[model samples]
Target: MIELLQDAHFWVGVALVIFLGILGYAGVHKIAWKLLGERGLKVQAQLDEAGKLRAEAEALLVQIKAQREAAEKQAALMLETAKEDAIRLGAEAKVKLDEQIKRRAALAERKIATAQAQAEADVKAAAADLATQAAETVLAARIAGAKSDPLIDAAVKTLAQRLQ
Candidate 1:
């Protein structure tokens, strides 16, 4: 037994036992366990924060999607309205153009009619002048020798009666 007690291996075993007894007496294991539990709690809190952020992100995504859909609908409506307006404006312009063309055509016809009437009046005046000159020549040839204050007086009396 003394030989075993004198062994270096036996003394190392005793030293190890004493060291473990000191650590247990001081409750070092409990302190270590407490620190590990606090670290775990911190990790849990971080995980909860991450979960909250994920939920917020998801909600934001949903809101953005809704907004995008609404914007698309509004854009489509605006486009439709613009197309309708364009069509209406085009129709109005066409109507106005047609009216203007008709007005212009009527004005042109009026001018042509006026010109024709004036031309006819001018032709009639020229024909009357020509007839008067022809009659004067015929009368002058027929009455070349016969002058006649009597004939002139008779013509004056007839013109006066016609005027009355």
Candidate 2:
């Protein structure tokens, strides 16, 4: 036992045990454990914060996607409305054009009727003049060397009655 007590390795081991006991009594291990626990809590808090930020980012992405879809729908509706308006305008223009064409055709027909009426009047007047001249020639040839005074008096009386 005396030889064991004088051993250098045993003395070193005893010294180490005494040092550890003194540290325990001084509360150094407790302080180290508390610091390690606080560090672990801080890391956990950071991880929770990161998770919250990631969730917020995902929510924002969903909101942006919804807004984009709404905008696309609005644009499509506007495009459809524009197409409808264009078609309506085209129909209205065609109606107006058809009305104008019909009006022009009616006007042309009226003008042609007036011209035909005028032409008929002119032809009738010419025919009447030619018939009167032919009758005058036949009368002059047939009554040659006849009683001119009596025939002239009778024709004047007949013309006066017809005029009235």
Candidate 3:
């Protein structure tokens, strides 16, 4: 036993035992365990925060998708309304154009009829003037060869005025 105590290996073993005894006496093991438990709790809290943020992001995404669908539906409705308005306006324009064309044609016909009536009246007046001149020439020739009577001369003057 005295030889084992004097050996270098036995002294190293004794030194290692004393070092471990000092660490145990100081409660280093309890401190290490407490630090590890605190680290695990911190990690768990971070994971819970991450999970809450993911849930919020998913909710926001769903709301955004719903809004997008509503916007698309509104856009389609507006487009359909615009198309209907265009078609209605086109129809109205066509009706107006047709009415204008009919009115113009009727006005043209009325103008042509008036012009023809005026022409007929002018022709009639010219025929009456020619007839009056021929009658005056025949009466003058006949009266110059006949005897001059006051009653006949007055009647001949009144006949020329009545013909005109």
Candidate 4:
């Protein structure tokens, strides 16, 4: 190792290393600052875009607040309208129910009147039938003891034929 260090090849290697270091520094570290100017331009553009976005966000916030208030007002109005509609509907239902009750009462009264008329007609028909049956029975009893059987049969047969 000490022999290599003392050799001329070692000095040549040192010279090459020094030249590469100078080349790297000169390329990477520029004094003209073109890269610095580009970085500054990029930063300025970002700041301008940020300022524009901040303004837009503030405008959006204002619009959102206005929309929220408008929506709240509309909801309140809708609720009020619904309440009024409910009240109106309830009143209408009451009116319709009252009308229905009156109609049903009238129909019931008519049915009751019809039933009474029918009952009176039935009673009259039953009374007439009873009178007819009673008259037939009384006339048959009066004629039964006085009449001869042959005379009665002849007379009854002739009367039945004539009636038919």
Candidate 5:
């Protein structure tokens, strides 16, 4: 028993036991356990908040994707509508241009007819003037060659007036 009391290892064991008993009497272990539990609860709450934020982010991403798809569809529809309108307008323009060309051709034909009519009238007037001059020249020659009776002179004057 004296040897055991003198052993260094036994003294150390005794000292450790006494220190543990003091800590228990002072409630230090309970305080340490409570602090650890509180730390654990804080970490769990942080994890829950992170999970909620992640879920919200995922939902927002999905909603944004849906909106983008809708916008793309709308854009495509607008493009198609624009293309159809362009085709329709192009056809309309072509039709109008064709109509204008036909109108111009008809107008040209009318102008040509009017010009031909004017030319014909001018040619007839010129022919009539030439015939009148020829008749006047022949009558003058006849008058110079022969003495004219009053009755013959009257007839010639009437004929000249009629020719003119």
Candidate 6:
């Protein structure tokens, strides 16, 4: 072995092979394993964080859903209240309108009654005026022209008796 190492080419070849083996071990085994191990730990931590974030997101989603449901219920109640209020207002308006119409009708009926009474009084007045005029004319004719016509005189006497 000493004799073989004493040859320069043989020692150089051995040193080259040992150096390449050390280089391969450093590049492919020790340094690579350490780096890969660290990378794997980092990936696992990230996965755990992702799971926690997913849970938080789910909780937030549930809260949002509950809020939306509550809002919808409130909206429905508000809509129902509005409808009830509208109905009440409409009924009140109808009642008021009916009262106004009744008032108008009553006024019209009162006017009609007043007109009827006035017409009746007018008829009575006209009749009375005609009767008085006829009486005056007969009295004048008798006083002015009473020389003859006993029938006219008797008729006039009967009318005076009836009038009295």
lDDT of 2 by residue, 1-164 (tens): 99999999999999999999999999999999999999999999999999999999999999999999999999999999999999999999999999999999999999999999999989997887676667666766666656677767578556544533
Ranking the candidates on lDDT from highest down gives 3, 5, 2, 6, 1, 4
Model 5, global lDDT = 0.92
* Model 1 CA deviation exceeding 4 Å by range: 1-21, 150-164
For model 6 the local lDDT of residue 84 reads: 100
The whole-model lDDT of each prediction reads: 0.87, 0.88, 0.94, 0.84, 0.92, 0.88
| Residue pairs with backbone overlap in model 4 | none
lDDT of 6 by residue, 21-119 (tens): 988877867778889999999999999999999999999999999999999999999999999999999999999999999999999999999999999
Reference-based TM-score of each model: 0.76, 0.58, 0.75, 0.57, 0.75, 0.61
Q: Enumerate clash totals for all models, in the order shown.
A: 0, 0, 0, 0, 0, 0
- Which number leads on lDDT? 3
The lDDT, on a scale of 0 to 1, for candidate 6 is 0.88
lDDT of 5 by residue, 1-164 (tens): 99999999999999999999999999999999999999999999999999999999999999999999999999999999999999999999999999999999999999999999999988988888788778777976797688867787787678768866
Error of 1 at 58 (Å): 1.0
Q: Residue 148 in candidate 3 has what lDDT?
A: 75
TM-score of 2: 0.58
Candidate 4 lDDT over 43-95, as tens digits, reads 99999999999999999999999999999999999999999999999999999
| Weakest ten-residue segment in model 2 by summed lDDT | 155-164
Q: On residues 1-164, what C-alpha lDDT tens digit does candidate 1 reach at each position?
A: 99999999999999999999999999998998999999999999999999999999999999999999999999999999999999999999999999999999999999999999999999997887677667666665666657767776567556544533
Instruction: Using lDDT as the measure, name the better of candidate 1 and candidate 2.
Output: 2
Per-residue error for 151 in candidate 2, Å, reads 8.8
